[model samples]
Target: MLTATLCALLLVNLWTILRFREDKRRAVAGARRIPEADLLALALIGGTPGAFFARHRFRHKTRKQPFSTWLWLIAAIQAGALIGFGWPR
Candidate 1:
């Protein structure tokens, strides 16, 4: 069960990175973009690491106002939860 959960998280993070890449591509092309809510939702669900990585790698949404604030908040909450509960057995 633990292995399965870890695998799922890996997949989700990969997906989040892909989404960030796609969003960056669209931004450069001036095309329709991925919604901030969707990106934040991905980070909220154990993709915070991926989100931060993609933000640095793609230089996407780094300085965005509320988005950056919200992403940091999500990371803080996730960190708090991990600290409170400890690692899975």
Candidate 2:
């Protein structure tokens, strides 16, 4: 169980990082953007850390109203849940 969880975390983080880099590329190339919902969904599913880092490192979506707010909110919730669920019995 722990192995699976850890694997998911790494994979999700990698995905988030790649997504951010791709988004930046498309933005500079004047191409279609990846959907915001897709990005948010990734964050909700254990990708929040990567998403947060990518946002700052790529300088994307930081100043966007409510988006940053939501990311932070999701991160906090995920952190709480992790603590709650992983608490020693």
Candidate 3:
């Protein structure tokens, strides 16, 4: 179970990072963009660490209002869950 979880996290992190890079490129070139929902879904699925880093690294979607709001909201929920349920006794 732990190994599977770690593998999922690693893959999602790489996926999120690539999405960030792609989205940034699209923004620069005026191409079709990845959806915000997709990015948020990636974060919610344990790729948040990567998403957080990508946000800063690419400077994409950092200052947006509701999107950033949702990202932080998801992060808060994840943290809360970890603390409340997953923390060691």
Best by TM-score: 1
**Residue-wise lDDT of candidate 2 within 1-89, one digit each (tens)?**
98998899999998998998898889899999998878888999889989989988999988887877888899899878879899545
Error of 2 at 79 (Å): 1.5
Residue pairs in candidate 1 whose N, alpha carbon or C atoms collide under 3 angstroms = none
TM-score of each: 0.96, 0.88, 0.93
Give the CA lDDT, 0 to 100, for residue 20 in model 3: 90
Better of 2 and 3 by lDDT: 3
Candidate 3 residue 88 Cα shift, in angstroms, is 4.9
After superposition, candidate 1 runs with Cα above 4 Å error = none
Residue-level lDDT tens digits of model 1 in 1-89: 98999999999999999999999999999999999999999999989999999999999999999999999999999988988898543
Cα lDDT, model 2, residue 47: 91
Worst 10 residues of 2 by lDDT: 80-89
Report each candidate's C-alpha RMSD, comma-separated, in the order given: 1.1, 1.7, 1.2
Give per-residue CA lDDT, model 3, range 1-89, as digits (tens). Answer: 97998898999999999999999999999999999999999999988999999999999999988999999999999999999996655
Give the TM-score ranking, best first.
1, 3, 2
> Highest lDDT among the candidates is held by which one?
1
**Of the pair 1 and 2, which is ahead by TM-score?**
1
Give lDDT: candidate 1, residue 78: 94
